[model samples]
Target: MASVQKETIIDADPADVWAVIGDFIDGPTRMAPGFVTNSRLEEPEVRIVTFADGTVAHERLIARDDQTRRIVYSVVGGTMHPTHDNASMQVFPHSEGRSRFVWIRDMQPDDLAIEVGAGMGHGLSVFKQTMESPR
Candidate 1:
């Protein structure tokens, strides 16, 4: 499996960041508005998201831990044909009122790595700005 990992420091509290990132349904759009055009909950833990490129993806929420400020999910179906796609995001307290956000994705067929890694890089950059900007 190929994996992509990204980390960023946001000038916000961990809980504050988690509050937005943890909301599986609306989080993507709110956390990375330009990248994720739309996100809606299909079921309790399933979500259908529309990307900026107009590609739609169905993801299932695997786990959410408030205490650890972490969330895990899998891409069940999407434009890309990957044998497997699992991703996770976690937030850690960096300093006074600052947070470190980490995003990781594991997929098969190694070729998927470049696309996912690039997406995560852009997503994380936007996420950091969205989180640090005035609320």
Candidate 2:
């Protein structure tokens, strides 16, 4: 499997970041407003999201741990090469009122690494900006 991991220091409280990320359905659209244009909940653990770049993906929630501030999901169907893809996002206390945000994706077909990595990079950048911006 091809894996990509991206981490960033978010200038916000870990709980605040988790609150945004833990929503599962409305989370992406609200947390990264522009990056994720729309999100529709198909079920309690499934969502369909449309991205800023006009890509659509169907994702299923794998696990969400409130105590650990972590969420795990898998791309069941998508425009991207998805032989198999599983992703996880976790938030940890970094410092006073700051959080360490980590996003990781594991997918098949190594050739798609560049595309997935770039998308993740942009998403993380947007997430940081959105989380740190005045609410």
Candidate 3:
């Protein structure tokens, strides 16, 4: 499997970041507003996500740890047909009023890692911008 990891420091409190990202059903759309246009729960552990690019993905929640501020999910069905896809995002306290965001994705077929990584990079940028903006 190919693994891709992306991390960034957000100029926001860890608790604040967790409050947005910890929401499994609405987190993506909330964190990266335009990037993730919409997200709705289909089941207790499953959600349908729609991206700004008009791509849709059916994701299954694997685990969510509020204590650790981490969420794990897998892409069960999506526009991109990957053999396997598992992703996790975690938030950690950084400076006095800042937080660290880390995203890691593991997927089959090394070639797909490039595209996935690029998307992740953009997503992180959007997330950071959103988190730092005034509420």
- Name the candidate that leads on lDDT: 3
Model 2 ranges off by over 4 Å: none
lDDT of 1 by residue, 92-114 (tens): 99999999999999999899899
Candidate 2 residue pairs that clash = none
State residue 31's C-alpha deviation in candidate 3, in Å: 0.9
lDDT, model 1: 0.92
TM-score: model 3 vs. ground truth: 0.97
lDDT for residue 31 in candidate 1, whole number 0-100: 92
Model 1 regions lying over 4 Å from their true place: none
Give the alpha carbon lDDT tens digit for every residue of 24-72 in model 2: 9999997788889999998778999999999999999999999999999
Superposed by TM-score, candidate 3 places the C-alpha of residue 10 at a distance from the truth, in angstroms, of 0.5
60 in model 2: Cα distance from truth in Å?
0.5
Candidate 1 weakest ten by summed lDDT: 75-84
Task: Indicate the TM-score of model 1.
Answer: 0.97
Model 2's TM-score against the true structure: 0.96
| Candidates ranked, most accurate by lDDT first | 3, 1, 2
